[model samples]
Target chain A: MNAEDRADHFIGRLDAAAAAVEQKLDALLAPSTLKGEIERPARLLEAIRYATLGGGKRLRPFLVIESAALFGLSGEGPLRAGCALEMVHCYSLVHDDLPAMDDDDLRRGRPTAHKAFDEATAILAGDALLTYAFDVLADPATHPDAAVRANLVLALARAAGLGGMVGGQALDLAAESAQKPLNQQEILTLQAMKTGALLRFAVDAGAILGAADQRQAATLTRYGAALGAAFQVADDILDAEGDAAALGKRAGKDAERGKATLVGLLGLEAAKARRDALVEEAIAALEETGLGDATATLAEAARFVALRNS
Target chain B: MNAEDRADHFIGRLDAAAAAVEQKLDALLAPSTLKGEIERPARLLEAIRYATLGGGKRLRPFLVIESAALFGLSGEGPLRAGCALEMVHCYSLVHDDLPAMDDDDLRRGRPTAHKAFDEATAILAGDALLTYAFDVLADPATHPDAAVRANLVLALARAAGLGGMVGGQALDLAAESAQKPLNQQEILTLQAMKTGALLRFAVDAGAILGAADQRQAATLTRYGAALGAAFQVADDILDAEGDAAALGKRAGKDAERGKATLVGLLGLEAAKARRDALVEEAIAALEETGLGDATATLAEAARFVALRNS
Candidate 1:
């Protein structure tokens, strides 16, 4: 296939995977309880569903699915793991949009969880969603291997907990009130933890689920790190100078909130340049994975990360 | 030992276990990062430590230790597992005290997490602590067998997730704004999820770690349920009638908040009777465990739940 055809095929696969994960999430969030569940309280379940089902690209889950594909893994286990990762992603957004946090009223063109439900409900929903992520991952259905499941749980906790996403958020909060502007290095660290960590985890998780060897895992992890970093840079670029109509959420808010971003540090031109280089770096890592044409869709994913406006 | 001496001995063991958990928590919350960490930001770490290290009876951890002792389970595995449970307990309290939630200023005679830090910090700290719980459970140090670790993670997530504690909190929030008082069955379901689930989980987790047979596990779980129910009832009785100074926080806030409690529905005297009956029920379950005198400390624990002024 030509490059354009391949890109189109990749997008199709991405959409299909997103739909699959959406179904998984819907079923998982349904009122029918899993083993050991006493009740799935209505309002809380509703709030959780609102936060999760309200749409995004489901890019994290897509990454997980594709990364597992690299290792000849597919089917329900990887799909469910991706859904688990997406739950964590969704929960973070719910909590981050709280009045005490970023205080966002809208997300993806709809009212944010807190705005729709109320602060207390939003907080509890976020808490439940986060808790449920582990529940999904630790379930035997996620992986037949207990060691793999345990590793996934540990890896996720490290990424999402302090010293990773939450700690990064704490840094972002401090950055807003810092006596001086954060240095580029500081912003890099913050961004890595706040956003990049989970993105990295998505593919790293695929590696775990697929039982990739050390070299393959490391290679995919490297690809993930670059793609994640590129994704953030593109985000900054879009937030700086892009179609507000295209991006379903707010734009220019980083500047409005004085959030530290690559676009803020490097000029937009340089940030775009960095993003392109990162895509190249990501593709290079994919090449190193020894999967050859199997990495084609994933390669398009890298380019898509750099090229997408939203 | 005679009954009183046995009771005294149980108290000593409880204190020792509390001290041990304190040390474990201190280490867990220290500046050092865990395996997959990038950085543990100062304020976030501080808020976490403040929430965790600030004094409590560590009743949940004690329950885990004593229950595990019933099967001769000891060492860092059980101790660390207990600490993991305590992290979840601490995180719950921190989030519960948030301005958007229960909005408290004091906890255990000190400023609540949100008060001591900020709302954002407290929320993030709570998030991190909750995340850290699974991190601890999934670690190899929690148990030798990967299956055991996976089981622990699944159990913790179930008890702590929407169908359990977080869901219960949502019910409590709904009750406060509820058009009518919660019915007796409704309150039981709420309390069982909110407070009872985690306490029950503590003992149930002990059984999991010890590889208890199905009957043994069921016996211990029944005891845990009764003990946990008794604990909440005693707490309600305390809130309704006793010990503002001894409880180290507000005593009558349930009434102030117009919250539903057993004391509110059944009145204080009937609540006390229920508490006594639960303690007896817990003792009976313990007797059925076939652990004999090994169950004595656990029996005392049930009594202590009923009799404690705090």
Candidate 2:
């Protein structure tokens, strides 16, 4: 198939997968017992729902499913993994927007959680969602194998916790200390931990779900790592070039804040070239696994990451 | 054996268990690969370590091990579970003391996390510790069963998240707006979710590690629920009457804020009576299980909760 036709087909599948994940999330979050008159905490629930449902490219979840598919496991387990990753992602964004953090007022074209509600509620909401993500994975109905579920939990915690996301955040804060100008390597390291780590987790988690052999899992890990870097590079490009309305967030804010970005460090053209190269490397890694049928859509998805408008 | 002698023996065992859990935590948080050249985020790590090692009664971790003993599963699994529960407890305490949360200046005779560091670092430290708790459980070496690990993750998440601790905090916040004093039911509900839920999870998670029958597990659950409530009641009593220096925190602060407490609603004498009754109930539940040897220390621990000064 031609690239455009292939891209269209991949997008359709991605949409279907995302819809399924949303449904599963609702079921997972629903109260188990309704026997008594349990008053729902409406505001907290609203914050969680708002943060989660706010529009963003469901790239992390998509990578999870696609990676699992490459390993010949396409079913409920992979879907649950996707949902869990998205929940963590949503939680991070909520906290990132808090007054004590990035303090952004807008996210995904809507007021941030703290802006919508109050700061305290937003903080609690993020904590609630983060805790709930693990609860979903632990649910008896979702993950049946104790060992695999534990692995997923551990993988997620490491990725999202201080050694991963929080660690990257701390570095980001330190790097932005008044007048410091971060080098390309430092910026790459920061982004790799901040964004790339979880994205890598999403793909690696899928391979774990498939219970792929060691060699096969390693290939998918490389694919995920490369794809994650590509995804961040593309994000940097969009922030520099895209319109705020189209991106659903304040564009060029990164540049204005003097935050480290691929575009800022590599220049726009070099950043674009790097994104392309990373996508190509990602597809090559997927090809090495020899699961051509399952990975065809994944290859196209990688290309779309480089080519998409927002 | 007399209560004092039994209590002493139990305390010693609990201390040993906590030390073991702390060692495991250190190992888990240590740098995984030297090639990464990533120094631990020292300040954040210091905050996490300080919060965790401040040395309260270690009640939650003790309950985890004691419950596992009831099912005859005494090994590294139970120890790991104990550590996981402690991590969650410590994380909650850190967040609870944030400027936007409780705004407390002291915890366990030391400065609260936010007071010791900056607000943002403390917040991230709590988040990191919480996520790390699940990581400990999901570690392949500790919990080989994916399904059981998932269940543990769910239990911890539900107990600690919005539906549990954070939810309780919201209720407490909203209760401030209510004109009428909170009733016994409302106070109990808040206490159950805020404190009892996690204590119960600690006990129940330990049970899940063993090969207990449904009947036996149910018996342990009943014991844990009653014990959890009794423990909270003691906390209420201490908050009402204990010395600040002895308790390692400000005493009577609950009453000063006009916050709802079992002691405030029931009066001091009645609260003490209820605590005794709950401890008796906890012991009775243990008796019903007919598993005395492994559960003896747990029963004694319940009574100790009622009588301890802080």
Candidate 3:
């Protein structure tokens, strides 16, 4: 199929994947009723449910499901892994929206967690979601093998922890008030950690689940790395040019805060060129995986990253 | 030995345990130096170290080490597990002391995390510590067995997640603006969840590590539950009667905030009576373990819970 038709076909599959994730998340985060003498508080679950349900592209889970598909491992395992990853993503957004952090009033075109609920509830909700993600991954339901479960737990923890997302966030905040502006290499490192680490984990999680051999896993890892960097560049492009209503968050934030971004350092055209090159590299990395057409949609995903408006 | 002397003996061990935990934590959370192009931020590590390194009684780790001692597993495994649990505890404290939560200015007789660092840094530090805890636990270094590592991650996640500590924190927040005051049973459930879950896990973790049989594990679980309840009651008593200088935090916070506390439900004397009963129950449960002399220090630990000044 041609690229446009391929992209269109993948978008349909993406919507289906997103719907499946929402259903899975709904069942996973169902409201609690006080059973027996023990009273399970409904408020925390309510906050978690609110933050997770009915939003986002569900791209991380889609990547997980798709990558696992490359190795012929589909069904509940990849989907559940996706849910856990989404929980981590949503939790980051919820905590990042707190008054003490980004202080954004809106996310996914709705009130942010701290805005929808009180700051205390929002903080607790984020903590619960993060803890729950690990719980979900460690459960026998996620993977039957104990080793796989342990590996998933370790991978997710490392990706989301100090050396990864949280550390990157610290760097991002430090950059804001920094006396010296972060140069290109520093900004690249910051973005890779804050945004790319979890994406890398999402793809790596599939390989771990599918039990890919070292070389196969390495190929997918490179693809994920390239895709992640491309995704960030596209995001920078969107921030520079997209509308707030379309984006569901404020646009021009990087420029407004003087936050160092690729688009800010390089002009829009040069940034677009960079994104296109990364997408090409991501697609090329998939060629060595020997999955043939099974990787076509992943290449489509890379293209989608380069061109998505929001 | 007399109960007083036994308690004193256990107190000395607790002090040693705390010292050991501090030393391990220093090694675990040491400042990072980058080997490659990537630079792990020093500021984030600084915040984590500042919040964790030199503070508190390290009571939770004491519980883990003491309980693990029951099973004759007193090498680096239990000590590392204790450090992980303490990291989770310290993270919770850091987040709980945020301006949006308790708004506490002092913790362990020093500036709270948010006060010492910016709010964003404190939040990131807490997130980092929580993430690092699981990373430490999942590492094979924590245990030789993969199954054991997975179980530790699972148990810690459950205790700290929506159904446990964070859930209780949410309930506590809901109670603040709640139209109706929580009744005795409701307050009991909340306290068990918020404060008791981690303590229960500390004991349970040791049982899991020592590979106790079902009956032995259950015995330790019961001991943990009773000890946890007693610990909360003692904390309430301290909040009501202890001096701020001694407590290292604002005294009478429950009364000032109109928080639902056991001491509020029962009068101070009655609360102390309840704490003593729980302590007896805790000691009684230890008797079933049949460790005999090996469990004396644990029994002494129960008494220490009832009478700790801070």
Candidate 4:
């Protein structure tokens, strides 16, 4: 394919993965009761569906699907596991948008889950979704191998839990009223936990699902880390310079809240330079995997992360 | 043994189990980072510890230990699993006490997690604890058998997710603003999801950890359902008639909020009667397990649930 056609192909693949995940999430979030349980509360399920199902770039699931495809395992297992990862992402968004957390009223051009529903429903929905992600991963259908499923649960819980995403958010909250701006290392650690951990998990999970060897897995880890950092820096750049209408949420709030970010520390031009170097680093790691052309899409993903406007 | 002596032994066993689990939670909540992660924030860890370390009856862990003992497995595995179950219980308390939920100012006679810390920390602490519960359960140390660990994750998630405790809370929240009092079936379903699910899981998880055969597992399920239901009915009875000083929460709020309960539907005497019958049913199920006196402590637990003052 030529350059333009290749770009279209990558976008098409990304969109297709998002749609697949959307369908999986819809089915997973249905009001039907599973075994060992009684009944699904309708409003809670509705809020969960609203928080997920139709928004965002679906970048996380796309990464999972593409990463799994690297090991020649383009099957239902990857898609199912990808949906589980996406559920965690959606749960975080729902909880973060609550009045107690980031307290935003808009997400992806729609009223936030709390605004559309009540705060109680939003909290319950977030809890249910997070729990269900583990449920899906542990189920026999996610993977026939019990060890793989168990490991996925362990890995995901860490990525989403203490010393990771939750800890990151706490650090960010504390940074808001701190006596001094965060040092670069502290900011990196916080960002890695808050956002980078989940993004890295997307690719790392694909490796687990594909049963990649230790060597292969480590290669993907490097790629995931670099890509995740690049994505966060790009996101910070957008928040700093992008418009609220294009961003679909409040923009320029990072500075307003006194939140420490790369853009604030490095200045826009240097941060842009950092993002470009990280993208190169990601692609280099992928090339080292020796999957060669099989990693073409992931290379594109690295570039895409650095370039996304919203 | 004399009756009093037997009671003393059971009480000691329960307290011992609680102490063991408390120690485990203390270690788990320490500000230490695990592999594949970054720093653990101090405030979040403190809030998690505060919510979990010193608290109400560790009844759930007691059930797990006692139930696992039925299969002659009295080891670290069951205790660790029990701690995981307790984490889930503590997380629910932290979230439920939030201003958006029960709006409680205190828990276990101290300021609620949200009150002691800010709402954001409490929310993150709850999320971290909940996520950490699954992390603990999925660890290789939780069980030698991957299938067992996977099954535990599946069971715990269902017990705690949409058709379980979270779902039940949502139902209760809706019922508070509901147009009318719920009917008997509605009230039963709501209560089952809200509280009975986790209580039931506390024993059912023991069965999973012990690798109980189908028939033995069914017997334990019967015991768990009866015990869990009896516990909840007793709780409702307390809310209706017990003092706030005794309950450590606002008394009679269920009636004030117009929340549906068996006590509201069937009256206090009838609810008490229901509680007693459930205890009988639980004891009978224990008797049927064919493990004979191995189930005696569980039988005692059923009675304790029905009779506790707080």
The best candidate in terms of lDDT: 1
**Residue-wise lDDT of candidate 4 within A4-113, one digit each (tens)?**
78778889999998888888778877766344445567788888889988887889989989999998777678888888888899889988988888899999999999
Full ranking by TM-score: 1, 4, 3, 2
Contacts from the true interface found in each model, as a fraction, amount to 0.89, 0.67, 0.74, 0.90
Instruction: Give stretches of model 2 more than 4 Å off.
Output: A31-38, B31-37, B144-147
CAPRI accuracy category, model 4: medium
Q: Candidate 3 — number of clashing residue pairs? A: 0
**DockQ (0 to 1) for model 4:** 0.75
**Per-residue alpha-carbon lDDT of candidate 2 for residues A1-310, written as tens digits (9 for 90 to 100):** 8867887788898788878877777666555531123454667777778788736768788888888877677788888888889999998888888877788998888999889888777888888888888876776544566667777887888889887888888777766663778888877877888888898898888877878888888888888778888888999999999888888888899999888888998899999999999999999998898777778877887787777777
Candidate 1 lands at a TM-score of 0.98
| Candidate 4: regions farther than 4 A off | A33-39, B33-37
Q: Enumerate residue pairs that collide in model 1.
A: none
Of 2 and 4, the candidate ranking higher by lDDT: 4
- Weakest lDDT window of 10 consecutive positions for candidate 4 chain B: B30-39
Output the lDDT of residue A161, model 2. Answer: 82
Q: What is the alpha-carbon lDDT for the whole of candidate 2?
A: 0.81
Model 1 per-residue lDDT tens digits across residues B1-310: 8878988998899999999999999988888645344556888888899999959889999888888878889989889899999999999999999988898898888999999889999999999999999999999988989999999999999899888999899989999998999989889888999999999999998999999999999999999899988999999998987787998888888999899999999998899999999999999999998888889889999999898998
Interface C-alpha root-mean-square deviation, candidates in order: 1.8, 2.7, 2.4, 1.8
Give the chain B TM-score achieved by candidate 4. Answer: 0.96
